[model samples]
Target: MKFEIKRDRLLDGLSDVMKAVSSKTAIPILTGVKMDVSAEGVSLTGSDSDITIQTFIPAEEDGKQILQVSEGGSIVLQARVFSEIIRKLPTNEVEIEINGNFQTHIRSGKSEFHLIGLDPLDYPHLPDVQEDELFTIPADLLKTIIRETVFAVSSSETRPVLTGVHWAVKDGELVCVATDSHRLARRKTKLESVQDEEHNAVVPGRSLNELNKILDDSADPVEVVMTSQQVLFRSKNILFFSRLLEGNYPDTSRLIPSEYKTQVTVNGRALLQAIDRASLLAREERNNVVRFSANGSDEVEVSSNSPEVGKVEEQLLAEAIEGEELKISFSAKFMMDALKAIDGQDVVIQFTGAMRPFILRSALDDSILQLILPVRTY
Candidate 1:
C-alpha cells in the first residue's frame, strides 16, 4: 500500500480512531492501527473487540484534494509509534509505502522510519449489522445529552450492565438513563425513527465518552444503526461501533417518586458554588456529605461539618420555597454533578423526605432529571 496524505488530515483521523486501540490487549494486532489505501481514499481503523472506530480521508472534499493514493492495499502498524511519527513529522504532507513482506516505510522531509507492519487480513472483521433500525439526531444535541447523563453510569465492573447508559425509545422520544445506585441522571429528546417500535439498549459509558471526544459540535446529523448485540454511530466519514452490554438495565421508573414533600427553586450557580465551598470541608468526612436546610420560603443554608476540618455554612436566597420545610444531607460531589448538568438559571429540588432520594431539575424543562440519595446525618 502506498499513499501521500496531508499530515494534519492523517493526524486527525488517527486521533479519532486511536481511542479504540488498547495497549493491554492480549492480541498483539489489536494494539495497532490498520491502514487501507484505495482509489477512493484512505481509511484508518482501530479496535479492541468491544469498540471499533474507523475514519476516512477522502481524495477530495468540497473540490479539494486531501489524499493521493498511488496503490491499493492494506497494512497494520504499531499504533503508538505510528501515531507519534505522523504527529511529529516536520512537513504538511506525509508519504507511506508498504512492501509485499509488510515492511512499512514512512517519510516526511529528511526524517524517515521503517516499521514492521502486519497483514491487514489478520485484523478481526468488525460486525456488519444490517441497517434494519436507524435514527438520526444533531451531533451537538447528542453530545449534550451524553454529557448530561453518561457521567452517572456506574464505574464498578461487578455488575457490568450498570456500567453502561440505558437508551430507550417511546412515543418518538429517546431517553438516556444512567445511575450508579447513589445517583441517577436522565435526559430525553425527540428522535427520528422509522417505525412505531420500542427499542432498548445499554451502551457502555466509556464508549460514549470516547465518541463524544471525537465528534464535533456541529449542526450536522449523526446516523445511528442498531442490532440486538451492537450499535453503530456514523458521522460524516467516521464510523463508531460498540458492542451492547448483555443484561437488562434496572427498571428505574419506580425509583423516581411521583410526589414530593417540598420543592424549592434556587439559582443553579449559587447552589453549585455553595456546594463547592462546602465540599472543601466535607472532603475530610466519610462521604463528603453536605447538608441543606430551608428556612421558611426565604433562604436555604448549605453547610458541612467535619470532625477534623471544622465546618462551613453558606446561605443562598431561594426564589420560591414551599411545602414542608426540610433538612437533608447528601454527597456534595453528587450534588455538584447534578447542578452542572442542569441547563437553566433556576433549579428545582424536590425532597421526598430526609432519607429518600431527592430530584433536581431545570425549572423550564422537564425532559432532564437528576436524583441523589440523601445520607442520614444525626
Candidate 2:
C-alpha cells in the first residue's frame, strides 16, 4: 500500500480514532489502527471491542488534493507510535508505504521512520449495525445531553445498568436519565428531525463521555443509529460506535416525586458558592455533607461541621420560600454538580420531607431535573 496525504488532515483523523485504542486490549491487533487506502480516499479505524471510532479523508476536497493513493491496500499500525510519529512530523506532507511483509515506512521532510504493522485481516471488523432503528439529534444538543446527565452514572459496577445512561424517546421528546442511586440527573429535549418513536437503550457512560469529546460543538444534525447490540453516532466524516449495556435499566421516572412539601427558590451562584465553602469543613468528615435548613419565611441556612475540623455556616436570602418547613442534608459534591448542570440563574429546590429525595432544578426550565437522596445525619 502506498499513499501520500496531508499531515494536518491525517493528524485530525488519528486524534479522533485514537480515542478507541487501548494498549491492554486482549486481541493484539486491537491495539493497532486499521488504515484502508483506496482510489477514492483513506479511512482510519480504531477499536477496543467496547467502542470503535472511524474517520475518513477524501482524496480531493474543495478541489484540493488531500490524499493521493497509488495502490489500494490495507494495514494495521501500532496506534500509539504511529499517532506520535504523525503528530511530530516536520513537514506538512506525509508519505506512507507498506510492504508485503507488513513493514510500514513513514517519510516526511528530513525525517523517516519504519514501523512493523499487523495484517489488516487479523483485525476485528466493526459490527454491521442496521440503520432501520435510527434517529437524528443536533450535535450540540447531544453533547449537552451527555454532559448534563453522565456525571450521575454509577462508577461502581455493583449494578451494571447504573453505569450507563438511559435514553428514551416518546412523542417527539427525548430524555436521557442517569443515576448512581444516591443521585440522579435527567434531561429532556424535543427532537427536530426525528418523529414519534419509543425506544429505550442504556449506553455506557464511559463510551458517551468519549463520544462527547470527539463530537464537534456545533448545531449540525448527528445521525444516531441504534441496533440490538450496538449504537452508532455519525456526524460529518466521523463515526462513533459503542456496545449497549445488556441489562434492563431500572424505571427512573418513578423516582421523581410528583409533588413536594417544600419549595425554595434561590440564586444558583450564591448557593453553589456557599456549598463550595461549606464543603471544605465537611471534606475531612469523609462524606462532604452540607446541611440545609429553612431559616425563616425568606431565608435558608447552609452549614457543615466536622469533629476534628471546623464548622461553616452561611445564610442565603431565598427569592421565595413556601410550603411546610424543611431541613435536608446531602453531599456537597453532588449538589455542586447539579448546580453546574442547571442552565438558569435561579434554582428551585423541592423537598417532599427531610427524609424523602429532594429535587434541585432550574427555576424557569422544566426540561432538566436533578434529584438527590438525602443523608441520614443524626
Candidate 3:
C-alpha cells in the first residue's frame, strides 16, 4: 500500500480517530490504527472494543487534490507513534508505503521513519447498524444535550448502567437523563424527523464525551442510528460506534417531584459565584456540603463551615421566594455542576423539603432540569 497526502489533512483524521485508541486494549491490534488506502480516498479507524471511530480523507475535494493513492491496500500502524510523526512532520506533504513484510515507511521534508505494521485483516469488523431507523439532530444542539447530562453519570462501576446516560425517544421528543444516585440531570428536545419511532438506549457517558470533542459546533445535521446493542453517530466524514451498556437503566421519571413545597428564583451567575466562594471552605470537609437557607426574604444565605479550616457566608438577593421557608444542605460540587449546566440568567429551584431532593431549572427554559439529593447533616 502506498499513499501521498496533505500532512494537515491526514493529521485531522488522525486526531479524531486517536480518541478511540487505548494502550490498555486487550486485543493487540486494537492499540494500532487501521489504515485503508483506496482509489478514492484514505480511511482511518481506531477502536478499543467499547468505542470505534473512523474518519475518511477524500482524494479530491472542491477540485483540489488532497490525497494521491498509488496502490489500494490496508495496514495497521501504531497510533501513538504515527500521530506524533504526522503532527511534527516538517512539510505539508507526506508519503507512506508498505512492503510485503508489513514494513511501513513514512517520509516528509528531510525526515523519514519506519514502523512495523499489522495486517488489517486481523482487526475486528465494525458493527452493522440499520440506517433506515435513524434520526437526525443539529450538531450544536446535540452537544448541548450531552453537556447538560453526561456530567451526572456515575463514575462508580458498581452499577454499570449508571455509568452511561439514558437516552429515550418517544413521539418525536428525545429525552436524555443521567444520574449517580446523588444527583440527576435531564434534558429534552423535539426531533422534527422522528414521529412514530421510539427508542431506548444507554449510551456510555465516556463515548458521548469523546464524540462531543470531535464534533464541531454547527447547525449541520448529525445522523444517529441505534440498535439494541450498538449505537452509531455519523457526521460529514466521520463514523462513531459505541456499544450500548447491557441491562435496563433504572426508571428515573419517578424521582423528579411533581410538586414543590418551597421555590426560589435567583440569578444563576450570582448563585454560582457564591457557591464557588463557599466551597473553598467546604472542600476541606469530606462531604463538601454547602448550606442554603431562604427565610421568606428577598435574600438567601449561602454558607459552609469546616472546623479545621474556616466558615464562609454570603447573602444574595433573590428575584422571588415563594412557598415555605427552607434550609437545605447539599454537595457544593453538585450544585456548581447543576448551575453551570443550566442555561439562562435566572434559575428557579424547587425544594420538596429539607431532606428531599431539590430541582433546579432555568427561569427561561423548562427543557432542562437538574436534581440534587440533599446531604444529611445533623
Candidate 4:
C-alpha cells in the first residue's frame, strides 16, 4: 500500500495495536502488523489469536488532512521493526510504498528503509461476530469498572473460567465479578439504557487489561457487540475483538454472605498504610499475612509477627467499630488490592466471622464490594 500519513497519528495507532502482537506466537505471520490502504483511509491490525485490535486513520479529520492516498494496496510488516522505524522517522509526514512482490519502502526526511513484507492474503481474518447483541457504556466508567475487579481474576489456568471476569447484565445494570478463590471482587453500575434481555459472558482478564490500556478515559461511549464465541468493543476509531473463554463462570452469589457479625469503618488510607507496613515483616516469614483486632470501642490494632524477623504493631482509630469483637488474619497483598479498588475516604469492613470471608465496601459508594477469605494462622 502507498500512502503519505501524519507521523504522530500513525505512531499513536501503532502504539495501541502493538499490544496485540506477540513475538512468540505460533503463527509466524501473526507477529506482523497488517496495513491496508484504500480510498477511505488506512487501517492497521494486530493480533495474537486471543485478542485483535484494529485502528483506522481517516483521510481527513476535523478539517485536517491526516492521510493522502497515492496508491491503494495492503502489506504486512514486522510489527516490532516497523513500529520502531516509524517512531524514529525524522519528519511529521511519513511516506510508505509497497512493491508488487511485498517489498515495503518507508521514507521521511533524509532517512529511508526497505523491508521485506509478508503476504497480506495470509493474514487470519478477524472474528465475524454479528452486531446483534450490543450495548453502550461510557469508556471512562468501563475502564473504572475493569480496574476495580479485573485484578482478582485467577492467574492460574487450571480453572479456565476463573481466569476471566464474569460480566452479567440485568435490568439496565451491569455487574463484573472476578475471583481467584482466595479473594473476590465485584463492581456494579447502571447503564443509561435498558436491554430487553439479560446477558452473561466470561471475558479473559488478560484481554480486558489490554483493552483498558487503549481505552480513552472520556465521556464518549463505547459500543460492545457480542456473539456466541467472540465479543467486540468499538469506539470512534478503534475496533477491539476478544475470544471468550469456553466454560461457564461459577455461581458466586452464594459466596457473598448475606449477614455480618462485625463491621469496622476506618480511614482507607490509614488502613492501607498499616497493612503496607505490616506486610514488610510478614513478607520476611513468607506469609504476607496481617492481623486486625479490635482494641477499643472504636480502635483497631494492626500487627504482624515473623519468627526470623521482628514484629510490627500499630494502633489506628476506627471511624466506627461495632458488633462482636473482631480479629481476622488475611493476606496483606489481597487486602491492599481491595483497598486500592475501593473509592472513598473511608471503607467499612464487614466480617461474618474470623474463619469466614470478610467484605470491604465504600462508605460513599454502595455499588462496589471486595471480599477476602481469612487465613488460618492456627
Candidate 5:
C-alpha cells in the first residue's frame, strides 16, 4: 500500500481515532491503527474491543486534492509512534509505502522512518449494526445532554449499571438520566422527526465523554443507529461505535418527587458563588456538607463549619419563598454541580422535606431537572 496525503488532514483523523486505541490490550493488533488506502480516500480505524472509531479523508474535496493513492491495500502501524512522527514532520505532506514483508516506510520533507507493520487481515472486524432503527439529533444538543448528565454517573464498579447514562426515547421525545445514588441529573428534548417506535439504551459514561470531545458544537445533524448490543454515531467524516451495557438500567422515574413542601427562588449565579465560598470551609470536613436554611423570609442563610478549620456564613436575598420553613444540609460538591448544569439565571429549588431529596430546576426551562439527597447534620 502506498499513499501521499496532506499532513494536517492525516493528523486530524489520527487524533480522533486514537481515543479508541489502548496500549494495554490483549490483542497486540488493537494497539495499532489500521489504515486502508483506496481509490476513493484513506480510512483510519482504531479499537480497544469496547469502542471503535473510524475517520476518512477524501481524495478530493472542493476541487482540492487531499490524498494521492498509488496502490490500494491495507496495513497497521503502531498508533502512538506514527502519530508522534506525523505531528513532528517538517512538511505539510507525508508519503507512506509498504513492502511485501510488511515493512512500512514513511517520508516527509528531509526526514524518514521505517516501522514494522501488522497484517490488516488479523484485526477484528467491526460489529455489523443494522441501520434500520435510526434517529437524528443536532450535534450541539447532543453535547448538551452529555454535559448535563454524564457527570452524575457513578464512578464505583459495585453497581456496573450506574456507571452509564440511561437513554430512552418514546414518541419522539428523548430523555437522558444519570445518577450515582446520591445525586441525579435528567435532561429531555424533542427529536427533529416524530417516530412511533420506543428505544432504550444505557451508554457508558466514558464513551459519551470521548464522543463529546470529538463532536463539534454545531446545528448539523448527527445520525444515530442502535442495535440491541451496539450503538453507532455518524457525523460528517467520522463513525463512532460503543457497546451498550448488558444489564437493565434501574427505573429512575419514581425517584423524582411529584410535590414539594418548601420552594425558594434565587439567582443561580449568586447561589453558586455563595456555595463556592461556603465550600472552602466545608471541604475540611469528611462529607463536605453545607447548611442551608430558609424561613419564609426574603433572605436565606448558607453556612458551613469545620472544627479544625473555620466557619463561613452568607445571607442571600431570595426572590420568593413559599410553603414551610426548611433547614437542609447537603454535599457542597453536589449542589455546585447541579447549579452549574442549570441553564437560566433564576433557579427554583423545591424541597419535599429536610431529609428527602430536593429538586433544582431553571425557572424558564422545565425540560432539565437536578436532584440531590440531603445529608444528616445534627
Candidate 6:
C-alpha cells in the first residue's frame, strides 16, 4: 500500500479510530490499526472485539487534497507508534508506503521511520449486520442522552450486565437507563418513528461515552442500526459499532416508585453547592454520606459529620415544599451526579420514605429522571 496524505487529516482520523484499540488486547493484531487505501479514499479501522471504530478520508475534498493513493492495498500498524508519529510529524504532508510483505515506511520532511507491519488479512473483520431495523436521531440528542445516563453504569466487573446502559424502545419513546445499584440515571426522548416496536438492548457505557466524544454537535441525524447482538452508529464519514452485552438487563421499571410521601423543589445549583461543601468533611467517612433535613416549610439543611474530621452544615431555600418534613442521608457523589444531569434551574426531589429510593428530576422536564438509594445513617 502506498499513500500520500496530509499530516493533520491523517491524525484526525487516527485519533477517532484509536479509541477502539486497546493496548492490552489479547490478539496482537487488535492492538494495531488497519489502514486501507483505495482509488477513492483512505480508510482506518480499529477494534478490540467489543467495540469497533472506523473513519474514512476522501482523496480530495473541496479544493484540498487530503490523500492520494498510488497503490490499492491494506496493512496493519502498531496503534501506539503510528498515532504518536502522525501527531508529532514536523511537516504538513506525509508519505506512507508498504511492500507486498507488509513492511511499512513512513516519511515526513526530513524525519523518516520504518515499522514492521502485519498483514491486514489476519485482522478480524467487522460484523456485516444485515438487519433492516434502524432509526435516526439527532446527533445532539444522542450525545445528551448518553451523557446524562452513562455515568451511572457500574464500574465493577462482578456484574457484567450492569456495566452497560440499558436501552429500551417502546411505543414512540426511547429510554436509556444506567445504575450502579447505589444510584440510577434515566433519560427518555420521544422518537419520530412512532410504532409498536419493542426492542431492548444493553450497550456498554464505556463504548457509548467514546461514541459521544467522537460525535459532533450537528443538526444531521445519526443513523442507528440495531441487531440482536450488535449496534451500529453511522454519521458523516465515521462508523461506530459495539457488541451488545449478553444476558437480560434487570427490569428496572419496578425500581422507580409510583408515589412519594415528601416532595421538595429546590434550586439545583444551590443544593449542589451545599452538598459539595458538606462532602468536604464527609469524604473521610466510608460512605461519604450527606444528610438532608427539611427544617421548615421553605428551607432545608444539608449537613455531614465525620467522627475524626469534624462536620459541616449548610442551608438551601426550597422553591416549594409539600407533604411532611423529611430527613434522609445519601452518598454525596450520587447527589452531585443527579444535580449535574438535571437541566432545569430548579429540581424536584420526591421521597417515598427515607429507606426507599427517591427521585430527583427537573420540575419542568419529565423526560429525565435520577434516582438515588438512600444510605443507612443510623
Whole-model Cα lDDT of every candidate shown, in order: 0.92, 0.92, 0.94, 0.92, 0.93, 0.91
lDDT (Cα, tens digit) per residue for candidate 5, span 1-378: 889999999999999999999999999999999998999999999999899999999999999999999998999999999999999999998999999889999999999999999999998998899978888998999999999899999999999989999989898999999999999999999998746799999999999999999999999889988889999999999999999988989888899999999999999999999998999998654688999999777999999998888899999999999999999999999999998899546999999998999999999899999999999988
- Give the per-residue lDDT of model 4 (tens digit) for 1-378: 688999999999999999999999999999999998998898999999999999999999999999999899989999999999999999988999998799999999999999999999999998998977789999999999999999999999899999999989888888999999999999999988656778889999999999999999998899988777898999999999999988878889899999998889999999999999999999645569999998456789999998788899999999898888978899999999999999546999999999999999999889999999999898
Error of 2 at 269 (Å): 1.8
lDDT of 3 by residue, 7-122 (tens): 99999999999999999977999999999889999999999999999999999999999998899899999999999999999999999999988999999998999999998899
What stretches of model 5 exceed 4 Å from their correct place?
Answer: none
Taking all chains together, the TM-score of candidate 3 against the true structure is 0.98
TM-score of each: 0.98, 0.97, 0.98, 0.98, 0.98, 0.97
User: Cα RMSD to native, each candidate?
Assistant: 1.0, 1.3, 1.0, 1.1, 1.1, 1.3
Clashes of each: 0, 0, 0, 0, 0, 0
Worst 10 residues of 5 by lDDT: 279-288
> In candidate 4, what residue range of length 10 has the lowest lDDT sum?
279-288
Superposition TM-score, candidate 6 onto the true structure: 0.97
Index of the highest-lDDT prediction: 3
Quote the positional error of residue 38 for candidate 6 in Å. 1.0
Q: Give the residue spans of candidate 3 off by over 4 A.
A: none
lDDT at 160 for candidate 4? 94
Worst 10 residues of 6 by lDDT: 191-200
Q: What value does the lDDT take at residue 231 in candidate 4? A: 87
Q: After superposition, how far is residue 122 of candidate 6 from its true place, in Å?
A: 0.8
